[model samples]
Structure formats: C-alpha cells, structure tokens
Target: MAKTKKNVNEMSFLDHLEELRWHLIRAVIAVFIAAIAAFIAKGFIFDTLIFGPTKPTFFTYDILCSISQSLGLDDSFCFNEAAFEIQSRTMAGQFSAHMWTAITAGFIIAFPYVLYELWKFISPGLHPNERKHSRGFIIISSILFFLGVLFGYYVICPLSINFLGTYQVSDKVHNDFDLSSYISLIRSSVLACGLIFELPIIIYFLAKVGVITPEFLRKYRKFALIIVLVVSAIITPPDIASQVIVAIPVLILYEVSIFIARFVTKRQNSKALKNV
Candidate 1:
C-alpha cells in the first residue's frame, strides 16, 4: 500500500505564529488544570510522596536493608531515620515552594497532553506514513518519562537523601536544610532523568531526519559514557556508588538509542530501495 502525503496548508509567517500560539495556549491550560489538582491534593503531594524519602521506612530503605542482610554485610542500611531537618527560613518560602512544586507536578502529570499539542503543531508537515508510524509517540514518551521519574524518586533521590542527610563533618553543625533546596534536589533529579530517558526517542527522530546515524552513536559511545558519568556526578551525591547507580540506566538508554537508530536507518534504506 502506498502512503499519501497530506497537502500542507501554506500560511504566512504570522499565520504560523498564530497556530503556534494556540498550541502553546492549550498546553499552558493543561498544565494549569493539572496544577490546580496538585494544589488541592496537598497532603498526598507533600506528606506522602515528597517526604517519603526522608523517612526511614521508605520502600527503598527496606529493600536495601534486605539486600545487605542477604549479602552478609553490616547493618549500615538499618538506620533509624534521616538526619536532616527541613526548615522554611523565609516568610514566603513555604508558600512559594508550594506553588512552584504544584506547577512542576502539573507539567509532569500533563506531559503526554503537552506532547500531543506539540505533535499536532508539527504533524501536518509530516508525511501520512510518518504520522501513522508515530501514532504511539505520546504514549511511549510518557511511559519512558514516568519510568524515569520513578527511577529518580525511588533510586537516585533515596541514595542522595540517605548519603547527604547522614553525612556530618562535625557534631556541632546540624543539617538544617532549607525547604526550597530540598525540593529543588527532588525536582531536578526527577526532571533530569525524565529528559535523559527520552534519548532513544530523540535518536529515533534524528535518525529519521538523517541528522544522526547508528554509526555516529556507536563511534561516540565511550565519550557518551564519560558525559553520562559527569552528568550523574552532578545530579547525584559525590560518591562513586551513587554516580554508578544513576549512570547505569542512562547507559542502557544510550545503547537502546543506538539500536533505534539502526532500525530507523534500515527502514529508510528499504523504503529508498522500493522507490528506486
């Protein structure tokens, strides 16, 4: 079956801007609506999810404890609680953090809708076959994003909290962490991982457009590892184990991206042969 290309509506630059403006407006509305819901559910957002890693009874801690026991290691993982105390020093610190956190959560939750709006703006220019092949773009991207978020929240964030919350240079100096700083760590970690996991999707598109190839990805594999390690080091605590833990998934995603590029190139080659 031959795929038909849709006739793209030609428009002036201002008209294109108008179309883009509408898409942006709709995306913003989606985020706003989701943010309102997040604001309404304050207890769940703050107490349950946000503060989960700070408690000793977090699921990750228990799993670590079990692993340590099974490995005949010391009870280092069997800590009673996180050492740091979170505080809002400024008068508007708590309120500001609450509002921004709600907005960030909204963006995270409405990610798929946001992607859909972006796709709508771009899809008209794509061939019908391209549009058809990319029908699952929003869903696949959303799943990868959420998985990355979970990995950050469960693995990376916990490791960071455990290490930083416990480390002490002196007994006299208390770990009185600012509320904003604490939330920022969580936000950056989750969002960074979410973006990182989109590497395969990014590579797929780049390959499709002939901007990058499987060979390029392969040639730069070692360099990519170095960059990933550097990124992992920046987001995670200054520990080899923490950096390695965060880098592992990212490295896996890179390998998957190489395969995606190869698949896209192979398909493009086959299509070219058919056309010839």
Candidate 2:
C-alpha cells in the first residue's frame, strides 16, 4: 500500500506532536511499570540472571567447556567463578548502578509494548492494506529482540566476562573492576544485541520502500560477512573462537533478512501482476 506524504497528512504539526506525545507517554508508563516489577524481583535479577555468567556452572560455561574438550583444549576457560571482584569506587556508585540496571532491565522487558506504541504512531500514515500486512510486526520484532538479548546475555556477555575478568598481564595487576564497569558490560551486551536483532525489520522496511534489495544483499554477501565478523570482534573476546561464535549467528540472521527481502519483493511483483 502506498504511504501518505508526511507533510500532506491531515494532522497539523502541532497535532502530530500531540499524538506523538501520547505514544511516548504510554511507552514510558509501560517501561516504568515493568521496571518496578523487575526491581521488586531484585534477588532473581541481581543474583540469578546478572551474576549467573560469572559462575562456572552457568550453562554457557558448561557448553564452552564441552566444546573445548572436544577440540582437545584445556577447558580452563570454563571457570567456577570469575577471578575479578566488582567494587564501588564512588559513594553513589552502587546505588546509581542499581537504579540504572533496573531501568535497562525495564526497557528490555517492556520492549514489545514500546514497539507497539511505535507501530501505533506509524500505522496512521500507512494505507489500510499496509496496516493489515503489518499485523504481526510487534510479535515478530519482539521475539527477535528477546532472542538476541538471550544470546548476548548467555553467550556473548559470559564469554566476555569470563575472558576479560580473568586476563592478567601480571599478578600484581589485580582485576578489581568497578561496579559501573561490570554493569556497562552487561548493559552493552543486552542493548547492542537488542538493536542488532532489529536488522530484519530494518531490511524489511528498506526493501518495502525500494531502498535495499535482495540482489544488493546477495552481491555484497562476502563484504557483509567481513563486516559481521568485525562487529563480533569489536563486541566480543579477542579469540578467533569467540569472534566466530558471535559472528555465525549474526551472519545467519543477515542471510535470513536477505530471504525476507526477496520474499517481499516477490510478493509485491505477484500482486502487481495480478492488478495488471
């Protein structure tokens, strides 16, 4: 379906802004309420989810150990606990970390509702046909986002924490990591993957609008692989193994996005032919 011109829309600028305000308000309320719920479940969040990666018995570590054993490498990478300690370097550091962590957790948990609000705002500009086609937007995007978050938390963050937390140039150089640093690692892992997982949605929109195409994605597939590996290397441990582990899933997602783009274009062609 054709999109309405933004400037020619019935709503005036002020009216559009007002409409946007309501969407933002609803989104904020959703996040805030979810955060409060997460805050009340402090034990589960702080110990079970947040700190689980630091323990050797964590599922990620166990999987890594098994992989290492198969490769004839010492499973030293699978540790019972990270050798580093998290400390608060400032008076308000611990409290600040807690508050922000809760907020981020809230945002993560409230992601679906947030997407719903966004879709509500954008849907008004779409044709009725387009709106109908987008019926599953919220569910599909939310599932992809949560899957990415789990991967980051369970796979990427744990590997990173296990590796960085243990790396030492000298015995004297202790790994007394600040609370803020630890939280940053976790936050980055969660948020980065959350955003990255939206690639399919992005490609969908781009393909829908004719900006990106299946052929374009296919033409530069090798280049995309390099970029994905580089991105994985940036966000993960230095080891090739870790980088490959992270890159593989992202590459697969990219391939899936290309297929989605192709399918969309094919459907559009079929529809156009039917109309003619």
Candidate 3:
C-alpha cells in the first residue's frame, strides 16, 4: 500500500522538516540519476554541446551571418575561423570539468521534477483553490526556464564568444582560454538567463503575498528600464546590437510580469471583498 500524506495542520514543526527532507532527498536522487546519464554521454556533452559556440560553423553564427548579409551590413558577426584555443592546465582539470558539467546538466534536466517536489512541499499550506489555480505552475516554470536556457545558448553565448574570443588588445596577447573558464562562462550564462526568465512567476507570487503591488512596479518603470539595460550590457557582448536584442526580450517579460501582477492584485481584492 502507498504511504498516506499527513495533514499539514496536524503536523508539528519537526514533521514539516522531516517532510521537507524527504522531498529534498528525492529531488537530489533525480538529479544524480540525470547527471550519471550526462556523464556517460561525454563525447556529445563536451564536443558537440559545450564547445559548439566556439566554432565558426555554429548555428547561431550562420543565422546571424545570414541576417547581417540580408541587411547589407558588414559581416562583423561572421568569422572564418575560431579565434581562441581552450586548454586544461591542471592535471585533473578535464575530469573535474566533466564531473561538474554533468552535474549542471543533470540539475537542468531534472528541473521539472525538482519543481514538482518543491510544489508538493508547499501545496499543503495553500488553500485548495490556490492549489487548483497553480496546477500549471511546474509546467509554465519549466517552459520559461527552457526558453531562457535556449536564448542564452543560441543568442547570448555565441555573441559573447564571438566578441570576446576574437577581441585583440595587442597581437602579442594570444587568447588561450582555460577549459574551466570557458565552461564557467557558458554555465553561468545559461543558468543566469534561465532564472532571469522566471520574472512573471516571481511577480505573481509577490503580488499574491501582498509584498508588491502593480502600481509599485509601474511607478518604478524607469528604474526598471535602466536596470534592464545595465543587465543586458553585462550579459551580452559590449555592442549596441547585442544589448538591444537581449533587452527587448527582457523588457517584454517585464511587461508581462506587470500584467500578471495586476491580475493577481485584482483577484486578491475580489477575494477580500467576497470575504467581507
């Protein structure tokens, strides 16, 4: 027989902690299984995916080159050859990179499961209506995260690699990047963008909790724009085109977040009035 779930109201603090521990354990196990798979696919993970952006024939490069040609702009984004070499300086550097990369991939692959575990932990505390309303939270969050990861991999990663890899302050300085450094850049970009794309979800929860209001978001619209531009500059290549491309999506997400926040606020007000 399956184990019955304990009622949240009847559970003590220790019981809550124990419940959380089990959820975390399950989530970790899922990640470990996924990571093992990633580790086993070393050739595909390393050669095809990790180092793909460094190659001139990368898909992003081809698309960007075509766009540039069609626009009659200089082929600044297109390159004939890779401009940098990656090397492992430490004796165990390759092994370490492979291990950590696998773990990162595992976490990403198992993100939906992790979210499910998280939702299971918290759902007991929410009202039945709230739980029903948020039935698609895991799916929506997973979709947003995957979209962000793709945007990072296909757009931000290639632009940064093309610019930074090809940049030459002096001919004397050769761009021989370390393996760890290269992997770190790709990992950070992919993960950072993935989290950043959860803006609307974050706003919805904040509004639900009365922590933030839609008017507050609108009042700080100018500040948010400046912050978005700054973040775009930080993430993308230091070029206007790259920055604009990044900023536009983020701006759109922000607007969507505002709409979500407003909807949440209106619903909360309606609930309050009904209760009265």
Most TM-score-accurate candidate? 3
lDDT of each: 0.88, 0.88, 0.92
- Tens digits of per-residue lDDT, candidate 2, 133-202, equal 9899999999999999998998889889988999999999999998899989999998899889889999
lDDT of 1 by residue, 170-232 (tens): 999999999999999899888988888898899989999999999999999999999999998
What's the distance in Å from true for residue 5, model 2?
19
Candidate 3 deviant stretches above 4 angstroms: 1-4
Candidate 3 lDDT score relative to the true structure: 0.92
- Candidate 3, 180-242: lDDT as tens digits: 999999999999999999999999899899898989999999999999999999988888888
Which residue pairs show backbone clashes in model 1? none
**C-alpha RMSD between model 2 and the true structure:** 3.4
Ranking by lDDT: 3, 1, 2
Worst 10 contiguous positions by lDDT, candidate 2: 1-10
Q: Higher TM-score: candidate 1 or 3?
A: 3
Ranking by TM-score: 3, 2, 1
lDDT of 2: 0.88
For candidate 1, the clash count comes to 0
